[model samples]
Target chain A: MRATTIHAPGDIRLSDVPDPALSAPTDAIVKVVAGAICGSDLWPYRGAKAITSGATVGHECVGVVEEIGGEVRDFRPGDFVIVPFVHCDNTCAHCRAGVQSACVNAGHTRSGQGEYAVVTQADGSLVKTRGVPHADLVPSLLTLTDVMATGWHAAVSAGVRPGSTAVVVGDGAVGLCAVIAAARMGAEKVVVLSRHEPRQQLARAFGATHVVADRGDAAISAVEEITDGIGADAVLECVGTAEALTTARRAARPGAIVGYVGAGHGVEMPVRPMFEKNVGLVGGMAPVRRYLPDLLDLVLEGAIDPGRVFDLTLPLDKVAEGYRAMHERRAIKVLLQP
Target chain B: MRATTIHAPGDIRLSDVPDPALSAPTDAIVKVVAGAICGSDLWPYRGAKAITSGATVGHECVGVVEEIGGEVRDFRPGDFVIVPFVHCDNTCAHCRAGVQSACVNAGHTRSGQGEYAVVTQADGSLVKTRGVPHADLVPSLLTLTDVMATGWHAAVSAGVRPGSTAVVVGDGAVGLCAVIAAARMGAEKVVVLSRHEPRQQLARAFGATHVVADRGDAAISAVEEITDGIGADAVLECVGTAEALTTARRAARPGAIVGYVGAGHGVEMPVRPMFEKNVGLVGGMAPVRRYLPDLLDLVLEGAIDPGRVFDLTLPLDKVAEGYRAMHERRAIKVLLQP
Candidate 1:
């Protein structure tokens, strides 16, 4: 199978890797139909995070189940499904609490950026789609496996109530998706902090009511001005950078919640200031599995087109170019057809 | 009027100061019937936080209204009320959001450790008691003005639910009060991290089901072990130091909330670990005014006795000794009779 591998920093390539087979009754083999590069992938691609010489890259996808172990009860061979980013038993207390990302029997399968990927805990991790989605809708459906679900998690975690103002910090696919999530959650005003023209356009299309091209204090002031100096009721921190966290913190109103899905590499909170402002800092790894059902429904019903995040798509053989596009800020997200 | 003043660090003195007056149209003059020293006072008294020479201290008290400015219409002369530490106009957006501590028109009354103090935003800051609480209930009622309300805020902000495990970090008055708040909120188990015997006793008295007389990693490990290695669902951080914050962070279960009310002087969040664990950090300046109505009812109904935090009493003239006792850990809290 041709799988994407990152052999050292800035070295992404297509390599022939072993095809997966179900190793446990709780497992299934997924023939990956589509996958997407994640913001987290840039961590190693930019050498900000260290990875092994050859690590199977990517953690998002939708696929058709080629085979399933006998114990996998909810799924069967030839079922088109959404594979959540984390593998979990789902019956554990954590998973039962809707935090499957922290499931007790947690494990990870090889990256989905491959032709065939092994999926453990298949019954709990795979969400069966109504049918194989159209190829045009595949990219959008694929996002439910992670990105869209993650963005929805931010809104749900922040308690973005109807008629409230929601602010999103970041211009990436997830951030744009958050704008859509907040809107779907009935937010009256959706604000975004973006400087890039393409991201700004996507953000507006996704229901961002206000866009602040300014950074730092200017951005915060822009939000404050739009909110009548009150700040947003809910803030979504989509970027894992310190600056993004700062924007989320500063943009939140007193008693507001700042829900962040950022893999905070070096993020730190100024406790005193946040304390004084009474901003509730919440959100982490999205319980993507928990949100998948609702989000998949939204996607299928045309309530949201979060899949539009995939502005660029490439054949599995051209995975390198996909990463390069994201690296160069040319693509908001890239869907790789395997 | 005689008031407690911090001439310099470790130099508390009872000094003659001018009587408070109606500095603003929203002000009221109160003759303090009861006042309590707070853990925060130790910060300046112990030279941890700088204070200007002759700056008045204390912020917690219950008093009788002596005079009211023309604009203060809620109460006439001779109404007993709980004076929350921070004064805020109830009409601001923050106050409307139930975050009175961050009200736009915020101000502070004169320090409670005085014969008379001026109350600003009287209509919003003063919670008129059903009547003068019995002399025996005075100290407890005084706690509702700040400590108890602050503790309640921690439990409320953390979203303490029935059958959830709660952990209280810090052995101070606020921590003890948090134990009571958690119990009141129906937490299944309330744990306290404390090495002080008196505080441990008080914590248990306030409904702490378990006591772990350990600090740092050991304290976290003790909690983890108690919860079958899952950690507590809610953690109340009453101490503002780094160590306390670290313990609270490490002791929370995945997706748990750590509600902290400490005035974080030098606190920071270790974002990576907390993010990976999906812990939500919330809580701030305990919108005491918002919780006063409920807490006052609890106190009046013989439900919670948070006033037990005040273990020592001193006359107004002995203000110096009161500071010394708390600074030396000889007293948990001091009540000043003016």
Candidate 2:
């Protein structure tokens, strides 16, 4: 089987690996049909985050169950499924409370960007489609594995309501998807902060009513100006940079919440401003598993086209080019066909 | 006129000061009927917070509007009113959103412990009762000015719901009041952390369903045991100390929110654990002005007895003793009559 592996900084390769096998009774062997590179993957490829020299990479995929363990009752061979980045039993206290990302018995899909991947907690983590749908819908279904679900989590956690104003910080795939989530949730105004022209245009196409090309303090000022100094009714922080978090917090109105889905690094939560303005900070590793069911339905019904985030695609063997394209900002996201 | 003044650390004095007068069109002269020593007062008195020598002290009081400025319309001479600790115009964007503490044109009542105090934003900051109430209801009305409303803010910010479990992480007047707030808000189980016997008894009397006397990590363990290791659905953080904040965050179940109201000192917000568990941190200085009307109605209707927190009383001249008693924990709270 060919799988994506990280060997060193700026080093991505499609290397031959052993085929995945079910290791537990709750596991299933998935033959990946489509997978996408994640923004988080850039952390290690850019040497910003330490990674094992030859570790499997990628956590977003749509696949067909090639085999299932004896105890996996809901899924079997030949079923098409969306694999959430994190696996959970779906019966833990956290999962029962709809916070599956914090499930006590959490697991991860092995070698997701590969020909075959082993999915643990199969019945609890995989959401099966009505059938292996047409090829045109696979990209949208693939996004539900991570990015699209994460974007929806941001909207829900920020408490986006009908007739409210929503501000999305960052213009990555997740941020663009968040624009769709906010619009779908009925926000009267959807403001996005993006300096990139291409991302901004896509954001507008996805439902952003306003776009700010400013950065840092300037971005905050722009958002404030757009909101008439009242600040956003809901703020979706899709980028985890300290500056982005600061902008998100400053963009919120008094009593409004900032729902952050990005993985934070070297970021200090702003306590004083958040306290004084009564702004709330919530959200984390999005419970994509919990949102997978509804999001899959939305994608199936053509209510949203989140797959548009994939601006480039390649054969699984050309995975290195996919990483390079995204690393250099030539592509918003790259889909790999296995 | 006699007003409570802070001379230095551990020093509280009732000093002769000039009689307060209407300083602005929105101001009114309040003839103090009741004023109480707050836990916050002890910060400066204990030297934890710096104070200007001879600065007027006390911010909680119920009084009669002895004189109204030219622009004052809703209040008039001899009208009984509850003066929120912080004054807000109540028409600013933040105020309209029910976060009066973040009001742009905020002010404070001048020397509330004195015989006559100047109230700014009078019409917006003072909630008038139907008439001069019976003496028995005065204490509860006084409480609405600060502690009771603050406790209610904690519960509201924590998103307390019917049948949910709530954990209060302080045992002071505010925390005890929070027990009542949580119960009134329909929490099925109200757990209070109180090591003091008297405060514990008071907490129980105020509708706390469970009392944990342990401190620090032990307290967290005790709460988990009480909730069968599931944690509280809502956590009210009435004390802003780092340890209290830590306990509050740790005691919340995944997806729970911790509403904090204490004036934080030397505290850092924990971002990692909060993000990991999807627990939200919110609340700050309580927006007491926004809650005055409804709380005043509850107090007037005898539906709540928040005044029970005031366990001691003294003549206005004995204001120093009132401070000493509260500082030494000899009294749960002290009420001074002027």
Candidate 3:
């Protein structure tokens, strides 16, 4: 099977790789239907993260179950499922506490690693739709696997509530989706801080009451103005950059929560100011397993179309182009059909 | 009128100063019945925080209303009252939200500045006991003004629950009082990290179920061992040091809350670790005005004795010795009688 591989910085290529097969009793093999490029994938593609030559790349995907090991009970061959980026045995203590990202036995499952992917703890990790979703809905549903759930976690961790004001600091697909999640959670006013027109438009479609094309001080002031000079009740730091984190902190009101889900990029917490404002900081990786069911329901019920984040699409053979489009900021997200 | 003043890093003197008089329509003059040293006070006495010569020092006091301005209707002369270290109008939006420490019109009212101190917003800042209490209860009741309320804030912010395990970082008066507060809040197990014999004894007396003399890794191990390796449900960071903050962070279980009341000093938030563990950090200066009434009731009911923190007492003339004693680590706290 052909898969995308990163041999070095700026050197993404399509190459032949072994198809995955069930390696454990609880595992299931899935044929990739659709895979999406992630911001985190940029880490290794840019050589910022350690990526071995010919290493598998993508972690977000929607796939069809091809085979199940003896222990797999909830899913079988031909089932369409949304696979969370992190695989977890839903029965673990952390998973039971709704923190699936920290599940004791959690592991990363990437579609780009192999055309046929082995999903561990199949019963707990795969969320099966009522049936095979229409091909057009695949991209949106694929998001439930990672980006959408991450956005949901950002909003939930920030304690966004009805009548609350929220500021999402990132123009990435995750940030755009965060605007949607905050709105769904009943935030009275959702402010998206982004300069990219595509992301800003999606943010508006996702119910952002206002969009500010500014960074840091200007962005914070815009939120404060919208919140009657009180700043936002919640600030979602979707960008892992130091600048984005600072903007999130500056935009939150005293006693407000700042939910940061970005992979750290040398962002030093502004402790003194955070302390003065009594702001609570909470968030990390997306607990997609815990949120997949509800988000999938939202997608199925047409409550939100998070897949709108994908602006570019390509065949799996052109996966290099998909990564390039995202890296160059020409697309918010890229969908690759296998 | 006589008042305690700091002349230098190690010199505290009691001398005649102009008696405080109402400067604003909302002000009331209070004759201090008792005032105690606070952990923060040591910052200046030990030269960690600069002090101007002749500056009044103490911020925690219990006093009797001596005079009231024309606008002060709720408080009258001769009413015994508990004065929160910070005076708040209690009508600001922040105060309405129960964060009085951030009240828009809050100000520090310290007895060290003068014998008769002016308390702003007498109607909202002062909580009076129904009547004058016996002299023996003055010291204990006086604690409601600061340390006790701060301790309560720590426990409350930490989300202490019945049957929850609580870990307290710091062995100062606030930490000792936190043990009492956690117990009062119904935490099943309260572990206090204290290496000092006097503080450990005080912690036990205040209802700490376990006293660990370790810090960092050992302290975390001790707490995990006590909780069957699950970690504590709530952690109270009463020490402002970075080490204490890290210890507190390491002590809580996922989804647990860490309430920190320490005036943060050199505390660097380990953002990634905190995010990975799903820990909630909530803390800042305690909103004493919000907790003074309930803490006073607890003291009045004889359910807690917070004054045990004061290990030394002295007349106003020996104010220097009180500061010296605390700075020298010879006393946990000092009570001054004017």
Candidate 4:
């Protein structure tokens, strides 16, 4: 079976690899319907993250259950499902606490291994839709597996409440989706910090009340201006860069919460300033399994169209171009049809 | 009017200073009956935080209102009260949200410089006990002004739920009080990290089930071992040191919460590890005004004796010695009687 592999920096390719099979009683084999590149993928693509040669390279997807192991009970063949980026047993103490991202038996599912990927704790990891979604809706539903859940987590963690103001610190798919999440969560004002015109427009479409093509102090001032000089009630750090993290910190009002979902890169938690402002920082990887059902419902009900994040799409064999387009900022997210 | 003042590092003096008068329409002048040296005072005495010569330096006190401004309605002259370290107007949006520590008109109250100290937003910043209590109950009631409230905030922010496990990371008065707070919050197991014999005994008396002498990694391992490798459900960071902060972070289970009330020193937030573990960090200066009523009731009813934090007591003239003892770590907290 053909799978995507990253051999080195700037060297992602679609190559023949062994097809995955259910190796555990709780595992289910998923036939990839649509997969996409995530912001985290850029870490390995840019060589910032250590990667072995010919390593499998994807952790987001929506697919159909093709096979199941003996212990798998909830899902059956041909069922459309959104697989959470992290697999969890769901019954563990942590998973029961709605922190499935930190499930005791949590593991990541990678798509670059083959057409079939084994999802551990299959009963808990996959959320099935009412039926096989239309091909056009597949990309958006696929994102429910990661980016959408992540964006939702960012909003939820930041404590974006009804009639509150929220500032999103990145303009990527996650940030744009955060705008949507904040809106859905009842934030009266959603501001997206984006310099890119296309991304800013998309942000507005997703419910951003304002767009500031600014960074750092300018961004903070912009948010404060919009919030009557009080700063945002919540700030979502969607980018892991130091500047983005600092901006998120400074843009929040005293006692405001900063929800960071970005993988730590250049980000450094500025302790003193955060302490003085009494800002609450809460975040990490998205507990997608905890949010999947609610988000999937929103998608099915047409409340959100996160697939709009995929500005470009291509066949699975053209995964390299998808990676290139994302890396070069030509596409926010690139959907790949298998 | 006589007041205590810090002339420089290691130098404290009590001398006559101008009596404080109402500086704002909402302000009130209070004659302090009791003021205590907090762990934060050591920061300036140790030269970690610079202090201007002859600056008044106490922030925790219980006093008798000597005068009230025209705008003060809820409080009046001759009222015995616990003054929150930070003054806040309770009507502000932040205060309405129960974060009086970050109130729109928040400001600090200085000790040492008067027979009278100005309490800003008198009606909101000072919470009067039901009635003037006997002199013997003064110390415990005074503690509700800051340390007790702070410890309570720490436990509350850490999400100490019934049947949960909680770890208090500090041997200071706040940490000892946190043991009480955790137990009061119904935590099934209360663990305290303390090497000091007195503190450990105090922790045990306050309901800590386990006492560990180690710091950081060792302490975390101890907690994990106690919780069957799952870590504590809640952690309170009561010491504002880098090591204590790290220890609190490490001791919490994935997705558990840490309530930090420490006035940060050189502490650096470990963003990556915290993110990976999905820990939630929340806390800041305690909104004493928010917790005063309940804590005062607990104290008045003899349900808790948080003032036990003050192992030593001295008259106002011996303020220098009190500061010296606390600065040199000879006392956990010192109560100054005027």
Docking level for model 1: high
| lDDT per residue as tens, model 1, A260-291 | 89999877887998899989888898888898
lDDT of 2 at B16: 89
lDDT (tens digit, per residue) of candidate 4 on A1-338: 77888999889888888888777899998998888888789898898988899978788887889999999999999998888989999999889888898898898888722476779999988899888888778878988888989999999989999999999999999998899999999999999999999999999999999999987777778888999888889999898777788888889887888998988864557567777777888889999999999888888889899899989988888888888899999999988777
How well does candidate 3 score on lDDT at residue A130? 81
* Deviation in Å, model 3, residue B101 alpha carbon: 0.9
lDDT of 2 by residue, A87-121 (tens): 99999989999999988888876577888888889
Off by over 4 Å in 1: none
* Sort by DockQ, top down from the best: 1, 4, 2, 3
Residue-by-residue lDDT tens digits, candidate 2, B162-261: 9999999999999988998999999999999998999999999899999999988898899999899989999999988888888999999999999988
- Which regions of candidate 4 fall more than 4 Å away from where they truly are? A112-114, B112-114
Q: Which candidate is the best by lDDT?
A: 2
Alpha-carbon runs more than 4 Å astray in model 3? A112-114, B112-114
Error of 3 at B13 (Å): 2.9
Residue A333: error of model 2 in Å? Answer: 1.5
| Tens-digit lDDT string for candidate 3 (A109-189) | 865434767788888899998888898789899889889999999999898999888999997999988999999999998
Cα distance off (Å), candidate 2, residue B58: 1.4
Q: What tens-digit string does per-residue lDDT give for candidate 1 at B276-299? A: 778888999988888888888888
TM match of model 1 to true structure: 0.98
- Candidate 2 CAPRI grade: medium
Which is the winner by lDDT between candidate 1 and candidate 3? 1
Q: Give, for candidate 1 chain A, the lowest lDDT window spanning 10 residues.
A: A104-113
Which pairs clash inside model 2? none
- The superposed Cα distance between candidate 1 and the true structure at residue B155, in angstroms, equals 0.4
Q: Rank the candidates by lDDT, best first.
A: 2, 1, 4, 3
